[model samples]
Target: MTAVRNVHERVIDAPAAAVGALLDRLSAADDPIFPTPAWPRMRLDRPLAVGADGGHGRIRYHVTAYEPGSRVRFDTPPGGGLDGYHELTVAPLGAERCRVRHVLECEVRGAGILQWGLVIRHLHDTMIEEIFDNIERAAAGGVARPVRWSPWVRLLHRLTWARPRAVGTPAEARLIRSSVDRPDYVDAYRVDLLPGLPRDPAAWTGVLRDAFPVLARDDGELLMDVNTAGLTARASILVDDRHVTLSTAVKTDSPRARAYWGVVKLVHPVMARTMLRRAHRALALAAPSAGERAQAQSPAPERS
Candidate 1:
């Protein structure tokens, strides 16, 4: 028997339970996003069940393992030469965000309808990609809202000093304060590519599929990370004034990190200049309110 594997990773704004529930729902339905034709019309019975116990071709496969908000596993038999497992893991990155990984592994038999390497490969890749794509759509509250952390849901976060551990010297304090902005408590950060042409998350996220060749070709993973943690970037309209504050307590004395920082210092000015130019272009297009314009033209406060 030949063996094959395919893996996909993504971060989403919804909770792990939400993603898992959607997957389970899809499995329960025959026409669950497998492209209409092959998706057996939804059967009234347990549609997702398949394998010896589930009634091969009826349910699809046997649920070998199931763990809520953690993982779910299933497999097919050897006769089909496509026995494999699907593992879904949810990692809480922020109070309301989760990182999801969907992985698949299968054994290819020497003789069977799906024995051909090319055919099996295509099936493994495309199907797995579809799984994540569907999950993303579902989690995004497509036509339906996914689970979310209410204000009552206490997220795990703690305040740390500007320095990681060791007390910062006077010089260090000045440098650290100059780069980072004060932390703001709110929903988690969501980092997705800047949407296409118009840069609108709503208008772009839908049509953005074409820009991603991996997804456009229907053969790739849509790795996404969602978090209410400060790490995420917001999905705001370009017209609004957006300010992103990046903060870190510098306690680590790691040699590697220091080395990288050393390199950054060399060209920081050039980078700043480039960013200013970009900002200028954006300001020109959006034209902030008069109040903002006045603030920008005002002189900076003298530092003590």
Candidate 2:
């Protein structure tokens, strides 16, 4: 068995009260810290309190202790090859300055040791620093320099990025479904619509670019014309509450078109899935940070 104890701390040019307020909002629906969109948002089964059970991504833990504006700790469930807890705390450094710190102490055995040294450590460090950056930006006004993901971290993120899954043509994609009667080819791919991603169908036009003209738009679906090589085709992008689907339908009216499609169909699915996955990641990266979203939503101070 190997024991690991990691600590990261940052001093912010803001009052401890201000910094602690940010900590108290962790796991909130409008969480302004903990770095997200780039990483998974922390979640809890209930509100931030004792017994709250949840964690970000594959990591699982539950709240063991909570002090409204000063500290919170989460302990991992037993028998996961990991034992111990992680916590965040805030302390006053001066009248107008404060320090925020995160500590993770755990014992790992077998494969858990190797995983912690190689993967979990790197990711946890980056996440903690990013969380501090958000604290500075939200409570201290701005961060002169923000943490950047190292090449190794970037590679790991890519390796772990979510991919699109093959799915049957959704019945909700009425535009594409009804566009072609007895269509010669059809395929669909879907990816979960992560929080903060745009729900507007127009924002997903990149899924079928190359100047595909929009033929129609339903509530959450955008239908586009993708005809070429004497073929008739329509693509639909559907953005529902839980998912985003990209569906394609094609009609080959002649022998030339049929032959062309036979060769294209083999590669079409691959391309469609790639495009959807790319767009999903791109939108996620471009989405506003939680702090930025909170600031934007905050009402302006009333004037005399």
Error of 1 at 134 (Å): 1.8
State every prediction's TM-score relative to the real structure: 0.37, 0.87
Q: Compared with the true structure, what per-residue lDDT tens digits does model 2 show for residues 128-206?
A: 9888888887886677888888999988887777789999999899989999989988899998876688999999998
- Candidate lDDT scores, in order, read 0.38, 0.87
Taking the tens digit of each residue's C-alpha lDDT, what string does model 1 give over 1-304? 7666777777866666655555555433322222211111222234443331342223245666666546656666556556776666667676656777877787766674343453445444544454454455545433133223222221110110011111212222232233224422111111112111123222222212223221111111121222222232111111111211111222213465456545653664344333333333332224322222222444223323
TM-score of 2: 0.87
Query: Model 1's lDDT to the true fold?
Result: 0.38
Among the numbered candidates, top lDDT falls to: 2
